[model samples]
Target chain A: MLSGKKRGLQSIEFLQAPIISSSASVAGPLESKSSWAEDFDWIMEDYLLGESSWERTETKVLQQVIQIALDKQQLSFEDIEVFLAGDLLDQIISSNYTARELKTPFLGLYGACSTMAEAILIGAMLVEGGFFTRLVAAAGSHHYTAERQFRFPTEQGVQPAPYSQWTATAAGALVLEAQGNGPRVSSITIGRIVDMNQKDANNLGAAMAPAAADTIHRHFLDLNRDSDYYDLVVTGDLGLVGQDLLEELFVQQGVVPKPNISDCGVLLYDGIPEVNAGGSGCGCSACMLCGPLLKKMYRGDLQRLLFVATGALMSPTSTNQGESIPGIAHAVAIEI
Target chain B: MTPDSNEERKKIEEQEYQQLVEQVRPRPNILLNCIWAFIIGGLICTLGQLILDYFRAQGMSMEDAGAMTAVSMIFLGALLTGLGWYDELGKKAGAGSIIPITGFANAIVASAMEYKREGYIFGVGARIFSIAGPTLLFGFVAAVIIGLVKYLTMLW
Candidate 1:
């Protein structure tokens, strides 16, 4: 039989397993809901850093945010037990280059845009499992860098379709510790990878909506919790189209939550124009996770939240092989 | 003997100067050069558009086609450079010929061709890798290091 103190400690340990103490994002004014554009030309001229590549921009932003966390917490890079990150770059350029500037051990992760939640869940598990006490999970995306690698350079004058997602140029970082009496990560529901065989890249919202709905539905079922329990449920970067489709899909499945469900892609580019649909990139959710959401959490504006970062796992090689893009979503629930 | 030598040297100097002037005279027509540059640049972009259309017709995704366009431009530039056509085009258009995607392709091919004459092991092979080698190296190294840091930071 365990002593009352031991039992209480064990319960606390489980409750505080993976706590997200803080977060931040580096985005342009458009990403912060200050502007909006219906076409890509406006974005090319007004939103982008015409001089620097994505790698440089992403690294600079990520370094700045990490520096803030380090300074605020008075924690040294060497003291961070683990650094987990992901990005859309083939080799995860932002995380890699940024890591070169830091002293912490790194873990390169790639789950497309769903990387933040994935990293958070993994970091939480490590902390809970007593593998490490302090873990930092960060992710970033640069419009130019992602464009050059996955699309075309801005100088090319390529017109983006309406359904196309504007790659959000930003980075997000979260520092997780085992000691805090903060809200603990109550449950994490890993998503099933869903491939809908949709070839139209422009219609990524439609391609990814089913997966988002599927994951959220399954997650709620697994935890035996209603959607109303959480104040907000956020999905990575599904944009306007995916959000609508997700709502409709949920209705069809007989699970209708309040309109409190939001998408990072849609919210990140609220006022920003020229981005016809909205922000979608590896950093879309990464920045959101670190920015407004973290600020709200710290302010006690949110008590329980579910962050589901989604990724469209489509590669040049896979597309070349005539394979349709498969989608993945990972959900991490945090309660304070 | 001194007077004759002086006269002979002056004649030689004047003749050499005139010959140099003749050698420096403009040969290529400026208008023709501009025309070729415009035509070549337009043609390259047209080809790129055609390729993009073809890819899209084949049901390739827009993002995929966008990426393919860049690759296609690089290859087209290399082919033109190898055939000595790009040099002629460059001579005519100046920066106009070099500003587009084809220009990067030409640079890579030209660099490789220039070094290939040196030898296979030390010249061609090594030099071919030199042009984009740094970009590849830096990109890869940066990614690996970031991965390592992320791994280490996650460890307790």
Candidate 2:
């Protein structure tokens, strides 16, 4: 089991199990009143955060969040060897601009809302492979920026369909070191693109649900574990609608993940009806994992967690071109 | 389960999954939305008529009063859009708010306000007509064809 080879179909067992030293989560004002607000490190008073543009505020949040994590452990930029960060922007602008400020060796990733998990899994692999002793995995998203980029402008008067998700204006950063005293990255399942020709952008949960189910199913298959293996299996940004679809998928596959299975998107809102379906974007799960979930782990309330971040990989251009939305989900298992 | 080896089976499976999704997904109540649209839209039209009547009572000609009512309605729509209330209205009113001339004004002002940050020339100027452009294009085409038919009928 400790062999440095691929374990199953699409999973990798990190022999070294890179440790998470410290983490920080920051969200916009919209999330300040959320159920888990107290768990967050900080919440901005406004989406702009006094910046002229939403993009700038997103970059500032990403940069400041990484610093916040490092500050918690008395670490500095010189202590980090690599930075893996991403955002939901045209070119991952927030991460790129933040990287330029930090001047750290960087890798910019784009997995849409799955960015946080994608970055974490890759960072864990690199640390276990002895590539670097220290790396930072971070991701963030802004509601306003995502609005103009994906849908219409923030102020544009288009009524959101009942199935539409509220893109979270949030970010999270975690410090991953080869050795530390915290939860360890035990294993990961890299997802595949699962597209059922679902073309409705307003219903991202539907488009992304299949990919989440596929990744989660394969994770269990590779680990040869039951639904009760992990203390909890939480999917990223699969709001209420996606959660229901996933339930059906589980029933079909003879998997009863009830009571243990949950969704970050649905939990983030905590019955905030105006959010339509629920919270989404990369930050939806990032903050959940870095904030409340991690606190639960530290408190020994949880022993094992499977964080499967789902993403609908479709751009406005692709939608206009009549292409279906393809979805992907990456799973990272953390054990304390 | 492993990826199905049979292509036909995979297609059928995908279809089944979508069907399952449909069963679970929530739908907007069509009847409720229609009712709200009817009420809100009717109120907006009634407001316009009230304005026309007020102008006509001032001894203004019928044509002048009608033109003033159109201007007043557009002004109100644009102001509401700027104040961000029009969109809130739009959420409930749906096609009821959209079928009138005020809806046309809302469409244009909304685009301009949204694109203001991108700049004047390329942003507001180029994109101002984005939402209402199609309506104007179709209106012109229909008008030209109808006028041509009327002229030919008169000659006949």
Best by TM-score: 2
Model 1 whole-model lDDT (C-alpha atoms):
0.71
Q: What is the TM-score of each candidate against the true structure?
A: 0.64, 0.95
> In lDDT terms, which candidate is top?
2
What digit string (tens of lDDT, one per residue) describes model 1 on residues A1-336?
752211211111245456666565666545654432221111222343443444566676777667666666677788788899888888887788888888678998998888888898888878877789888888878776676556543333233555678888777787888886456677677777765555556656666776787788877776666777789999988888778777876776777565369999988888667787778887788777676776677778888888889888888677667777788888888777
The residue ranges of model 1 lying beyond 4 angstroms of the native Cα positions read A1-14, A32-53, A181-183, A257-259, B1-156
CAPRI grade, predicted model 2? medium
True-vs-predicted CA distance for residue A27, candidate 1, Å = 1.2
Error of 1 at A203 (Å): 2.3
For every model shown, the clashing-pair count is 29, 0
Q: Where does candidate 2 clash, by residue pair?
A: none
Name the top DockQ candidate.
Answer: 2
